[model samples]
Target: MVIQKKVGFISVLFIISMHSWCQQQINLVDKFQNQKIKAVNRSITLYGDQRDAIELNAENSSGIGIIEDLEFEKGIIEIELLGENNPGKSFIGIAFNIQNNDTYEAVYFRPFNFVAEEQIRKEHMVQYIYHPEFTWRKLRSERTGIFEKGIRIPPDPEDWFKVSIHIKENNIEVYVNDLSEPSLIVDRLSSTKSKKIGVWSGYGSSGRFKNLIIK
Candidate 1:
């Protein structure tokens, strides 16, 4: 019908737009720049946060704080981070293609749980999450082993360790300390595509991060 043809044309245009976006050259990783970000939590402040380094003070509250900027689709995102033992819920990582802090794909680490005596807690070390919809809770409940898995190699969970995340199309590979192999890999990104990039932390969790490079 006529309506069907119009819909098809619109879809084609959208696809073309996305293709152009993907090809657009951006060089944020070349230098550490103080870029602007839309924080998911207004209560959490980043007044002293820096481009080469960032320390978040959650003020003893729990919630996801994200940076809604970067508009990164695919490439490598690497950073060195140290999660504080106090305020103690360590869910630190990067949230990409962030529609918002509440809506995005994030691969975070639960350092406290990394070396827990219990296997269940150990299994919670590294995770892939889709906010507001499929959290680590829902992913554990329904998808089970698909979205989250244990880390075989444990770096000083509380100390600074480098993490490198490589994204290509719908696939994402997470590299912890060791870059030779991925600690976790996701076969699918979002149908919406990943555009935004930011360091994220759970509520009450404070962290120190540096050397963020994206190419």
Candidate 2:
């Protein structure tokens, strides 16, 4: 009887430990300052007069706004993103495990492709890539359909949508809005070193981000 009681006590402690280890940390978007991010070929600005979010506008090439104060390894990242329906001009999403401005793994969305009628366009809605090596062009030409997928139920390309990315070890799962199922799942193609996380925008893209939550 005593042994059983001790085992039960251990189980309770284990649950408590796990819960504490996975506590969620919410970032106050309005409190972000321009100086807190390192912008690369992007215009960083506060969005809305309320300043409740940050915006990134890319120039002629892909750009990123890396949060200089934050570092992430593996956890759940949630953020609200807004973009236009401009074809090939509204690519936006999150970048993680960023080694630098030119190196990182990212999962970005082509907003215009959200509800595309063409099968080929729809399949390019969400993309996963590791820079300086595995780019979207190479992935499409070599491992087509493996790293990108069409959203089962597309969201409005010009509206605000929530994205949740789950990173665990070498695997990443992307969830759009409150969907019970992941929109895309892919294995990490680069080193799993802990690094900075940031907002990403492709050429000619403008993105607004807010309400970042890390767990």
Error of 2 at 75 (Å): 1.1
lDDT of 1 by residue, 1-215 (tens): 99999999999999999877655333322222334544455233332334446555554533443443455777888888777443247778877777754678878887887668888777777888877687778988998887777777877776888888887787888888974878888775375554667667776676665666666
Candidate 1 local Cα displacement, residue 59, angstroms: 5.9
How does each model score on TM-score? 0.73, 0.87
Q: Model 2, 96-160: lDDT tens per residue?
A: 88887888899999989987999999888888999979999999999989999988888999888
What is the Å distance of residue 29 in model 2 from its true position? 4.1
Best by lDDT: 2
